[model samples]
Target: GESVGLHLPTLSVQEGDNSIINCAYSNSASDYFIWYKQESGKGPQFIIDIRSNMDKRQGQRVTVLLNKTVKHLSLQIAATQPGDSAVYFCAENSREGAQKLVFGQGTRLTINP
Candidate 1:
């Protein structure tokens, strides 16, 4: 079965510092990647996304990178803030098959004052 996992379970960054979260997916066939931010007691919210055809995509204060060669995906957040504290997840989807998205285990991002 295809699965996704985070390189680290948790990441800590000082306020105003940049933060990076990494995820590796087993599905080489994945064609789309999305980064989601999940706050406590709330559903995941879309942050950024990239397609296999592109190497990187940027959104407001955030970026998503895809490395198809390594089946790796990463999310970068600029200027970490208290509001950025949450669990981040990377999800992959392949258009070739049943149209399902596989989510990574998620990484807890802690923002320090």
Candidate 2:
């Protein structure tokens, strides 16, 4: 079990709109950052990732932005749909051997019709 310290309990959004999920990381040394979308009971699925050296990265309808100076991370979903509704969170990894991902508090995204 990964630790996503308490944060926002949930979020609601209308269908066919953009969604933004914010996260805060405790480790400033973490070099790798990832955004994952986990369904109700399934495993987390990777959406996008960015490294400490990078400020932003895009994939499909998702974009990940990392602010190392402020230790902040955010995921932006474009034209979100009903299927996009899920628990979205951010993860950080150490650059050292045996990289293990540490998860942050997740924000549940609900798409309202």
Candidate 3:
């Protein structure tokens, strides 16, 4: 299924701690996936992306894991910070026309002092 709208949940973590955000996608044929971080009043910023052919990919202080068997994806952030607090979202590249990114429900990450 394609996601036209999203309802994000909330996740709270302490500073200096690691935070893990999980997302589920309905399209098994989606070959590409991306993780984005959206700050207040700003657009979504790209963090990392993984292809369906791969199981894992890593970037600066960030990691993305894809599980095709279960249709699950996760992003791992190292050392949570106040600036890292934002709404995280996962998007799946559509296989149909235009190949637009279909975003899943996001997760709000809150860092406590």
Candidate 4:
């Protein structure tokens, strides 16, 4: 089954720094990967994504590196700041009939002065 809790709260971080968020998935055959950043009371915005076929993909100040060899995924934020403060999430979609998505523990990013 997929991994996620009923009420797992997000994480927090400071401003002007790099942040590393980790995620653990249940399915070993997940084919697609996506990262989303959601603000207070807003929809999750797409940050970056990768596929099971490849290993790493980078964009803007954010970099997504996938380690399918161990079913692990990570997101790296460079020079994080006030605007970068938000909830970060990692999701994996299995290559099945329905192709459902599995979410992981969300991290709440907080910027500091």
Candidate 2 residue pairs in clash (backbone atoms < 3 Å): none
Candidates in order have lDDT scores of 0.91, 0.84, 0.87, 0.78
Clashes of each: 0, 0, 0, 3
Better of 1 and 4 by lDDT: 1
Candidate 2: which stretches are off by over 4 Å?
A: 1-7
lDDT of 1: 0.91
| Backbone clash total, candidate 2 | 0
Candidate 2's residue-wise lDDT over 9-74, tens digit each?
Answer: 588989989988888777777888888899998999988889899999989998888877878888
Error of 2 at 11 (Å): 1.0
Against the true structure, candidate 3 reaches a TM-score of 0.90
Query: In model 4, where is the ten-residue run with the lowest total lDDT?
Result: 4-13
Clashing pairs in 1: none
Cα distance off (Å), candidate 2, residue 41: 1.6
- The best-first sequence of candidates by TM-score reads 1, 3, 2, 4
Best-to-worst ranking by lDDT: 1, 3, 2, 4
Question: Which 10 consecutive positions of candidate 2 have the poorest summed lDDT?
Answer: 1-10
Judged by whole-model lDDT over C-alpha atoms, candidate 4 comes out at: 0.78
Candidate 4 lDDT, 1-113, residue by residue in tens: 66732123554567767878877676776889889899989998989999988888889998888887767788889888788888888888876677576777688767776
